[model samples]
Target: MQAEIGTPEAVGLSSERLERIVPWMRGYVEAGKLPGLSVTVARRGQVVFSRSAGLRDLARGLPMDDDTIVRIYSMTKPLTSVAILMLYEEGRFQLDDPITRFLPEFRNMRVLVGGSRAKPETVPAERDITFRDLLTHTSGLTYGFMDATLVDRMYREEGVDFQTAETSLADVVAKAAGLPLLAQPGAEWNYSIATDVLGHLVAVISGQPFDAFLRERIIRPLGMVDTDFHVPPEKIARFASNYALGEGGRLTLIDDAREGRYAKPRSVPSGGGGLVSTASDYARFCRFMLGGGALDGVRLLGRKTVALMTANHLRGDLADMGQPRFSESSYSGIGFGLGVSVMLDPAKAQILGTPGEVAWGGAASTAFWIDPAEDLFVILLTQLMPSSTWPIRRELRVLTYAALIE
Candidate 1:
């Protein structure tokens, strides 16, 4: 599919800047690398640059429209964390509350011991899993995809479904409960199914299904019309196909569309990885977070709560927090906040930005960062994998930051 080159005036973008970024984006498409891409940058609550490039569907040769929806994998975590924090603001619960306060199954959990393949030794949990641990990923939950250890292998063997699978959130939690934790709760950082478990807790605490609570609290108030776990019939065609690098440098389409399983009201709305959203819709969320728990008089969280959520809550060696597969990537040594990654040291993070810049991405290569110090929020969307490997993000950050030079 050919690229849609909107003039600077047509899209309210700076022509020179758009022209500059377009080549890098198009180069990948022209090189048979990426299939579809869309990026939007906002400054002080107004979109200064919004551009859609490449084909949304390579088979049909559909151009990526501005409104095309992309699957946002882990990016859902921040929003889910916010919803959880909103409950915190309502005096519904405390961050330090043991998760057992809501879910009893986790009350007396045990940690894995001996060898990776060995059965977990029954050591009494030193402490109960707290809501904060869930938020920061300090809770010893494991994502089946990121590792290949015994427990991780077991997670996959049992089909620990993330975004693409048909499993419900309750199914995920029940499976997680049976698995041995990699470490004691709050003892070390290991990114796991902790957020998905938090989703179930959200359901248990709010007395409403996770999806309903999120809609009633965050999505509705923020005007995120196109953000949800499933897409309706009308929006399905515009949904971009998931793409990945294939043999011999070819781009192959992988179908990730939601089946009927996700279409109906789901019992498990994954607080961790169950959201599909557009660049614009997600921008509203990023904007609200950048605006300090409020947007246009619609405040979803208290200013103090938003501040706490973004603050670095990790202690001890930051490396103990979670073992990211991409440890060498810029996010290494970074701290996890309630639902997002907190940049403790720009030098340590190796990203060209200020400290305290909170960020997260989805499995489908969707990413966004809220730089409160710079008053900047940058969101990039694409249906692919290994989001950090791309130069688009780093270059975009540099370009965006360079433009703000005083």
Candidate 2:
């Protein structure tokens, strides 16, 4: 139902090799590694392999379908990045401009220099954080769940969570500003709440609520009808139950589709990791990225802008940028682009991927990558918490590229 479900051979993929995906998926389901999942592989502009396997709701006897909606988490970053870039294209602000021109909550931001969580030593940032810093995740912002440092603890203590409706985005930014940054702006490439800050920047710059802006501009324009911050009551039936890999290798129910936070509207949507989407719906978004920021004749971004966004903006690979242990990709050869991770060298990363392929994944293990070199893209959707629970993304990469016969 997404693009055209054509034969794999037509797109330089082996039909017989593509069949290997089903058994591999069933292996995970049968082994209790995944409850249900779906994969969409498209070449050029047409889908050559698309399949949904296993059960979406284990208790409800619901099988994973092409339209099943699941929390896409951080995959929401690219959309938010594109939204802000649209404002950039209007000459609203320069990439190097200090973000103090924006909300100004971060005007007095400090960098952590020494001391402990109880009483940390800090120094005023030598330079103001920029829009480019936020886009590249070099803004020194940190997420609460990283749970790795004092800044992260401060975020949690301040209740600066973004994936909830309880706190406003404005309030979260204000709280984040009160804490010391994990690093100096543009000094380190920490995976952080930078995108959430970008979401607030979108609201401030666009004079529109973040969710409203996204729906009116990117989502609706790209035909991602099922992509949103929350699942409406009418569409709750298609919302998959979220699970956590529990002790003894059991699937633990975390969020039920019948009643979850996503069932209600989000007051402050997280640009980093707060959106639900389907395989087909997400495929539409991927098509937009592959089409140079247009889908079906509607262009939201120019070709040069799209190229700039996908190109690696970091000085070098992520490892050289002082990336932390927690990340959506390997640090060795992967590089950070504007809002996505750009593969720099598969040999150095020790992964099977082409250089320049752009990707990002969610906390629930959902992932998508667009490979301009291959004229290909792949989307994987599942509802599992803490993406580190499995090596599926890496394995899926191997399974996928190995099937390309051309």
Candidate 3:
């Protein structure tokens, strides 16, 4: 269902201030810093501000719009986390349960003790990796591209990247199991393939393929029509081009919408970063979270489960774990929850945000945050690679909050 569009004043925000987002976003497109962008803001279930700028396809001159589908990347994690919690409510698995119960390969795991990538020394893991470890990213798993540690090198050697189309989720997990973990289970926060494992677990426990489970259980229920693991033939025209900053700060096409791998389905559906969605479709998902796991009378999770998922599960600041190489959010006042980052202290974060705000961004410069405090949520969609390339999320937050008059 489409959200009801309303004036900012209706939602207790200044219409004049909300209009500033247009020029601010247009400046990036006009300067050729971004190919295109779309922003959506909703308050109390009404869409207060929604606008798009620039082109979805530069060559074709297709402008970005509400329906333009883009790769959401790591934003897929929150959905995956929600799916896990849905199954948890059904008595599928416990948060602290060892993942080895279903995926035995994770049992008797080894951690990198002390050695080089060529011949890494290892020791047995202190304990089996649990669902909490996977959810909180403390499972010792590491993304191959995020760091250059020995385990990360091993991940590279084992073909542990997420872009592959041939390898299945099971195949990737098996390969990852053979490689030594970067740290012991629950040792420290390491953004890794843990969510992919959770995706595989979703398949294992639900007895359905990961994509099938997500589609039938979550996507369809939420009415996220344009969201899926791959863009179909008819929807190809609506898919946005993925780009990266090139030499001398020019937008370079990195993935073509029509010819990219996302144009077709893959065996391995990356739960951590492998879904495509439009601004409206994703806003629906965010609205579901904001509604306490329900939207438009369709409840995907219990309200208590939603509360549990958004709560800060981490003991202290995420920065204390280690310097985060991927996420742009300040770790000082941030703590991780099931699949998204939870704001713990806005003062220490030095960002215009509230505690209990749950959010996450994608690798392709897309971000969404749910502010339960203000009954607000914002979605910023774009096609730039390495979300860190620009401080758009932080700036968007400032722009969004400054517009609130009430």
The sequence of per-residue lDDT tens digits that candidate 1 reaches over residues 94-137 is 88888887777776777776554555455666888888888877
lDDT per model, in order? Answer: 0.73, 0.90, 0.91
**Each prediction's TM-score versus the true structure:** 0.90, 0.98, 0.98
| Regions of candidate 2 where Cα sits further than 4 Å from its true position | none
Ten contiguous residues minimizing lDDT sum, candidate 1: 1-10
Candidate 1 contains a number of clashing pairs equal to 9
| Comparison by lDDT, 1 against 2, better one | 2
Model 1 TM-score is: 0.90
Please give the ranking of all candidate structures by lDDT, highest first, separated by commas: 3, 2, 1
- Tens digit per residue, CA lDDT, model 2, 1-406: 2587778888899988888889999999999999999998999688988898888899998999989999999999999999999999999999899999987778878899789877899999989999999999999988889898888888898888897637788888888888899999999989899999999999999999998999999998888989999999999999999999888989999989888889998777999888899988888888888889888889999988999999999999999988575898889999988899999999999989999999999999999999999999999999888898899899899989998999
lDDT tens per residue, model 3, 190-220: 8888898999999999999998999999999
